[model samples]
Target chain A: MQLDVVVGFFLLGMVAQLLKAPIKMPKGLYESLTLFLLIAIGLKGGVALNSHASGDLLIQAAAIIGFGLVLPLIAFPILYKMGGLSRIDSASVAAHYGSVSVATFAVAMTVVEANGIEYEPYFPLFVALLEVPAIAVGLWLARDRNQELDLKKAAHEIFLNQGVLLLVGGLLIGWWAGARTDSLMPFFSSLFHGVLALFLLEMGRIASSQLGVLRNFGSFIASFGVLMPLVGAGLGALLAHALELSTGGVILLATLGSSASYIAVPAAMVVALPKANQSLSITASLAITFPFNVLVGIPLYSVLVGHWS
Target chain B: MKKRAFAFEMAVSFVLMALGLVLVQLGLPGYGLVVVAAILMGLSFVTRKWVAQTANVKVAAPKRGNH
Candidate 1:
């Protein structure tokens, strides 16, 4: 599997940033690319969902929700007690790990495709499903400090979030359109890599910029960024084994479990955990965990899936 | 001035949606791209509204402080 094309662009972005090169994507363009990727992914999944049995879909959805809910609970104690982070910081970081990274999931999908591994078509639905519950769990864990946690507001934020909305909407549209969605392949499928390359370049730039901030958080947080993913993957592997997921499905699950939310969860955290350190969560997710997952974790998880399945 | 900015933002969004429609009409393989284009368009409007709301808060803050 040639991962170089995607990884290379990522490296290019990071290198350019490190060199302080003036390369920059227009903010709107970057956001548009993200919109494209999320909708495309969701639509693809929805189209696939049309042919899949309802029972299997329900089972998978339940399993994924369970998987998502557990991740933050697993991370919080470790962060709060072991890492000695403050309550807000631990919960914030835990929430990040609990939710999924669309970018890392994209990379994992690319790898699976490159390797010609068969995966669940509704995996995108899993992506959408997994985004919410961990956030709910994370917020719940931080409930002590955040006395005024509004369930209504949090629900509105999580469910109505742009990323979630686009993904779910695309899924519904794709399911409704069925084979008629074939016409969309040229725009959504053909140009996927090119758009992904552009998106990743921007990510590399952002991640590199965040690197300077990592030093302030200390070795524990830095190590937690790497360590939490491994732990997530281990648990994911066990779940995949028990669920009897395919190699591709296992990889996807592991990736989902291992990857942290830089986009959705952080946005939620800003509103939900007002006192939480935004930089700590963002740095841990985007700067450390994201790069780690894309570059190393994906391949490692793939190997783990191979061993498990 | 705020109304004018909001209108301008909406116009840009409409144009983006139109562009997406054109991509679909051209018989692109991925009709889903239309949805992507539409999402971008919707996002433009949402962003504009968010910006407007934020600007309003910023403008109102000083007035409130003076009291």
Candidate 2:
């Protein structure tokens, strides 16, 4: 039942794109859907934040941030030396993998909820936190003293990014309002799956549009996109185990770790690493990593979490 | 000009936050709605910056010809 609803919409998206169907989500509607999902996730997290021990939350947060920072560092060397990508391209791609994708996260949430699995609510906070550091790491990896870095612009782009602001702001509002805001449960919670289905349908369309570019990127990059998520999930599983997170929390973290950012990081990279190959990084994230996570990584991670726990 | 844009964005964000609060009070599913408000506010700021940047590019293009 869980698989059919989530994956069915995604497959429908791909089929629509494949058939050259004229169906399209309105220009800003997709963004609106994204904003709604993020906030919904954040508010839920805020409500649950008080129940968890502050120390455990802090440790989990720190570990997730560390995961974000480390993923790029691991990716850069592989891209630069093994994949034969230039420093800029490597950093750009690495930054993308390091950052979390909200769409992918949303899909994972849907799967978990459909399956009646409980997860950590503050995962949205991790989403917000994970967005920034990888970007910094990416820019640093590509840094050259000869090139003038626009520190001010980069900071503004990262901190004030729409994704980060929405998630963080929602978290604060949800936390502050708590059960007082329970009235919103009907909209935020009940309608979540429907909104998610709509969003995934669009995601399928977008991901399918990139199908033609896969061959051009070569077998190596394509393989890396699929394999890296598994590696990241493995790391997430280990972290989740260490933190003693519940099975649901473990899967969520694994999903977070496995997913790649197509939105926030790309926007920042446009400003910070202007010379980076935009197509390569975008394709890697949106075309390859995004689909893989939604289709395979989420379920795989859930199984792994079950085994681990 | 930038300051004005920033202030405008802040105003919009505040309004959205208020609307979200009202929704919550009304026992509606408003948490996600509030975040949407925040996102829209941020988009306003981003669009303003984009427009300003485009203008800068246009202005700077002719100047670069002199070099």
For all predictions, the C-alpha RMSD in Å is 16.8, 16.7
The residue pairs that clash in candidate 2, if any, are A45-A121, A183-B27, A184-B28, A184-B29
Give stretches of model 2 more than 4 Å off: A1-4, B1-67
Cα lDDT of model 2 by residue, A10-120, tens digit: 889999899998776888999898888888988887777645538767877888899999999988887777667888999999999999998888888778877888877
What lDDT tens digits, residue by residue, belong to model 1 across residues B1-67?
A: 3344334334434553564466456543223324433543464455556666878999999999998
Error of 1 at A14 (Å): 0.6
Q: Candidate 1 chain B, which ten residues in sequence have the lowest lDDT sum?
A: B28-37
Model 1 C-alpha lDDT per residue in residues A1-309, reported as the tens digit of each score: 234479788989999999999896776998999999999899999899887748866887898899999999999987887666788888989989999999999999998988888888888988999899988998888888528787788788888888889989999998889899999989999999999999999999999999877546644465567667877877887787677778898888888889999888887888888889999999989987888777767875675466446
Best by lDDT: 1
Per-prediction TM-score, please?
A: 0.80, 0.79
lDDT of 1: 0.80
Share of native interface contacts present in candidate 1: 0.00
